[model samples]
Target: MSSSRRVRPLTALALAASAVGTLLVTAPTASAGDYAGACIRSVGSRTSPNGWLIPARNFQAGSSGTCVREIQFDIAATIGLDPADAPGFIDGAFGPKTDRYVREFQSRSHLEPDGIVGPRTWEALISRTTD
Candidate 1:
């Protein structure tokens, strides 16, 4: 009924709006570190927490071993490639189908589509998985 009463409600409304704005502005968005996917591992390497090393040797079709399997798992999981349909499906063997998926992931990730997983590719894959 008085000027002070009216001002108090307006001030309260303004404070509420400001608080909401602040929250919206400060809200965290998805980042490279936010990826908590199952494929991510800590290999204790200097490169990434995701474990897959920047390969001393490139991994391409015909490569095989645990590292290859890890790469296949990361790439497939990152790109949402169905494991059931993924050739090898973490079998640790790099085959033609795995090569194709790697190339697809590379192209999407703005990397060279050589189907080879090197340091750069491993970094990109790790970054993407976190995203």
Candidate 2:
């Protein structure tokens, strides 16, 4: 997917508003469990336009950036991509290294690998139900 299509956590509030009718957004709580549960519910149940589950691992306040980073790590790890051998920082910034990780993930997943976290890519990331 193109970079324009990627949903940056910085813009989550806006992006989420776009999902008004079809998607459900739970009240933001301090608990990670709340976020995790909500994420699983939101991403697992719905299929994006690209037929993939939009990623739910990101969108937390302080951890939004970290959420994306964790996603890059988890997805790449799950798919056996290169750099899967490496550990991610779990910081929320899309730095050069994170960009590389994302590209690698995209390639492994057979997506465009543009390093953008769009609905299509997110769909692929959340394909499996979260525990």
Candidate 3:
């Protein structure tokens, strides 16, 4: 014996619509406090000086640059991690400490627990700054 399953056109449409609705309902939305009062500094002509622009490449362990420095500062500030306690804080180096903090932040934000600082993580960090 063979079993066959068939979906009516109306049922298919309803299922698609329901899926879309669910996505819309569960989608994350930035709140007023997210980016309204966030202070992102500008570096010359760079549109995103504070590393707001998603980098061409993912920032992982060992990545170092001005953008990395900006990301470090933002992540530290977002997670309320004091930079004063640590020497060379926000030094633009993605080290173990930074990875740990990033993971912690990601966990808190319900993001993937990967240590790489990508666009989604950056958005979550940048948009969550308090005035």
Candidate 4:
């Protein structure tokens, strides 16, 4: 019945649109591994005090100083290989050598021939530790 009441709906719609726009702008089209660049995403999970599990993404190599060497160690461990046998050092840079290891791991895991380490590759790597 008043100006404030009339503007409430408009304000709500504006806020909703703004939020959606923000999410769209911030969200990556694909996960970090989607790009062939030297960056990858590392996800971690920890139990909260409330007994709820929370999964977190450690966005490494993209504005984050994640060393490729560290990621390679995890990937190697994930694929049931020793880092010493891998072609790359535990450096944080993702280079040709790392790609070679990724390819080998993919073949061993029976995944597609893509060297990109997507969610599936990550899952396989995690499974290795569990098994």
State which candidate has the highest lDDT. Answer: 1
Give the whole-model CA lDDT for all candidates, comma-separated.
Answer: 0.68, 0.54, 0.67, 0.53
Q: Which 10 consecutive positions of candidate 4 have the poorest summed lDDT?
A: 55-64
Per-residue lDDT tens digits for candidate 1, residues 45-83, read 445335644444567898886567667767767886764
Candidate 3 lDDT over 1-131, as tens digits, reads 55988899999999999999999999876443333223223222222335564444467789876656766676767776755536676666888888888898899999898988776776776577634
Residue 41, candidate 1: Cα error in Å is: 13
Q: What are the clashing pairs of model 1? A: 43-51
Of the pair 1 and 3, which is ahead by TM-score?
Answer: 1
Candidate 2 residues lying further than 4 Å off, grouped into runs, are 1-47, 50-66, 79-88, 128-131
The lDDT, on a scale of 0 to 1, for candidate 3 is 0.67
Judged by TM-score, which candidate is best? Answer: 1
Question: Considering lDDT, which of the candidate structures 1 and 2 is the better prediction for this target?
Answer: 1
What TM-score do all the candidates reach, one by one?
A: 0.55, 0.46, 0.54, 0.43
- Candidate 3 regions exceeding 4 Å error are 1-53, 82-85
Better model by lDDT: candidate 1 vs candidate 4: 1
Mind giving the per-residue lDDT tens digits that candidate 2 earns over 1-131? 66577668869877667777435465443333343344556555445776654544333223344345546445544554444535544444566666666677668779887777666666665553244
